[model samples]
Target: MNFAKPLPNYLVKRYHGWKATTYSENQVWYRRLATEGQRPRAMVISCCDSRVHVTSIFGADQGEFFIHRNIANLVPPYAPDGDHHGTSAAIEYAVTALKVAHLIVLGHSQCGGVQGCIDMCKGQAPQLEAKESFVGRWMDILKPKFDLVADVEDSTDQARQLERQAVVASLENLMTFPFVSSAVEAGSLSLHGLWTDIGEGGLQCYDPKEGKFSEV
Candidate 1:
């Protein structure tokens, strides 16, 4: 319980710089956000990859997006077992409490979590297969989707396809939640799946009707 530590020097310096410039320039807006609270219109469930900048991609300002980042951006099927479900909890809060109109699952290229899921499913990552490995258990949510891309011959192509599949899988799982589905059925909520190419700075969105992701 004594593991907490002070902020690193670099981060502290960066914070000071941001506070002096960005915070000073937008003090009024920041104060209003503090007093009025956040009323974000959308909730973005994205991978925890540092390269995936959700705000920058959308050109969003403060209090614009309610974002939840996790490995592979996977959402498990609605499980009301009273276990510690961080992703599910975030979704519930966003949909039921925040009442966000749009819920987006954002996946990105070269996702380590997706790669890990692929490797683990192929029996290549023995460590992740261990019962005690949190990452392994979490990646299990995407294991079923691995088979969809397993037939692809090239490793790189396979990984890329699986990354998109990860987004699709999460969107499907989101519908399993009663509140999410109810909101959608009532036309109060919408779901989207997006994939970004980190290297090329390209984006694609899933089209449920076409059954594929198209450039956006």
Candidate 2:
């Protein structure tokens, strides 16, 4: 398949147009962003889904947020594995290097990656590839949550539970990192879990009082 040939020509042309316009009108802001290294006050760990954009949702511009996105927006427990740990590395940079004060785990409703966990728990797992893929392996971290919530009353409720659980679980994982834990202990770092319902345009905070998600 000729991938390049399949793209709509107008869409590709617009990128060049945007690049030129940004260079012209936003020159001062662009120069400042270039000169002053990124010093984002908050960092967000979110899903790679096109619908859940951290910058757009937060109404942030360039150099505003240091974001790390993955399938289901996971953060695994810290370990010195001799492998490429993309999420872990990003977390390290955000905490140790960037020194961001707040870290947010942004989970969304109807997440496909969380659904993958639900499917795996129900014994209808997706087929595995020969080599370990990142999303597949990361979803395993939430396997226990899936197993615990698999028999919930409603399918939508089950999925929502899984999403919130994953968010909390990832926060726990963030604490597993020594740098993050140290900063948190010194009150230099704080963590939060948020669930955004795209359909209703509602933002919910993980409420400890109700031990569940609630509207903000």
Candidate 3:
């Protein structure tokens, strides 16, 4: 495919403006981050949703976190497959190579994938065809928990429960990785489950002691 194209006027201006201020205003940060390859303290596995940006939420600058984003932010149990494993590979690098101190599985409210999965499980959504959609296969990872927690009396309640279940399920699956397991066992690494509500602007954390998520 033919490549060069005129830059958008606004983008060109923004790029030049950033460049002008970068070395003087942002030099200290750039120097520190560039001194070494990424040496992040945490790795965040988050949804591919644009609104769910991890670094911005945590006010982190470059190289502060090793991030992996995918549809629904699901971490499927490690398996040898020919298919792309972008998220898995990110995890491997962060845990084994970078040796991040913590791993956070970040899930959020109003997650379309989780809602779609709930609808599919309740027979309200269209059946999946392998040739056309991996929805069925992707959500299959959350099936049992969704079924266990489905709200029979209220549809809205069922949706809320499904979102929560997704977070818990992913956290459990995260530990299935041998590196994660070893780190947790040796107290070198820790796992945290977090849920973000965009509308509420609240960050709730899962509390195993109370078996419920509480506001952070």
Candidate 4:
């Protein structure tokens, strides 16, 4: 805590401005959310990319969405090892505790995490290939997907294809959670996969019937 000494002046000023503006306008709503706890309608699993703004893109109000962000927006197959699984923990909390109606996995183009996986698979990243690398181990969930898109001739195109597959992979993995699958089968929960093109600001939704993402 000592390293986090004083708050920056600019951030302090911005906090004050927000407190006076949005916070003041929604004072009653904020109070209600605090007292009654959150009942978010949906849980969004998205990449930890600054360019992918889930709330802003969806025009969501505070507490409306239970958002979880991780590298490449991936979800490993349900593994209850009792280890420190941050992403799995968040997913468990959202599905079992929050009981969100919709669980959406959001992926994006030009994802660094996906690119890292590609590099690792091609033996371009020795660091990621090491057993001690946390990121490399985490991205192992995505290594299988590389083969799914390996036919693409272009490297960048292959990366983009892999990125989209990450969403589909997460959706499939979500069903691996017993609680999540039961909820879905009971008509209490639904699953969705989405991809975004940050450079063009385009959004696409995966069509299970069509087996591809189309503009939304």
lDDT per residue for candidate 2 within 1-216, as digits (tens), equals 655565588987987798889667898988998998899999999999888978878899888899989989888999888888988989988999999999999999899999887876776765622136655677888886776686798999989889999997898888899999999899999988898987877888876567787788
Clashing pairs in 2: none
47-158 per-residue lDDT for model 1 (tens digits): 9999999999999999999999999999999999989999999999999999999999999999999999999988999999999999999999999998899899999999
Writing each residue's lDDT as its tens digit, candidate 4 over 14-115 gives: 999999999999999999999999999999999999989999889999999999999999999998888888888888899889999999999999999999
Off by over 4 Å in 3: 3-10, 22-24, 127-131
Model 2 TM-score, all chains together: 0.90
| lDDT value for model 1 | 0.97
Candidate 4 residue runs with Cα over 4 Å from true position: none
Top candidate by TM-score? 1
TM-score comparison, 2 vs 3, better candidate: 2
Top candidate when judged by lDDT against the true structure: 1
Off by over 4 Å in 2: 1-8, 20-23, 126-133
Backbone clash pairs in model 4 (N, Cα, C under 3 Å; residues 3+ apart or in different chains), count: 0
Q: Which ten residues in a row have the lowest lDDT in candidate 1?
A: 144-153
Report the Cα lDDT for residue 104, model 1: 94
How do all models score by TM-score?
A: 0.98, 0.90, 0.88, 0.96
Supply the global lDDT for candidate 2: 0.86
Pairwise lDDT winner, candidates 1 and 2: 1
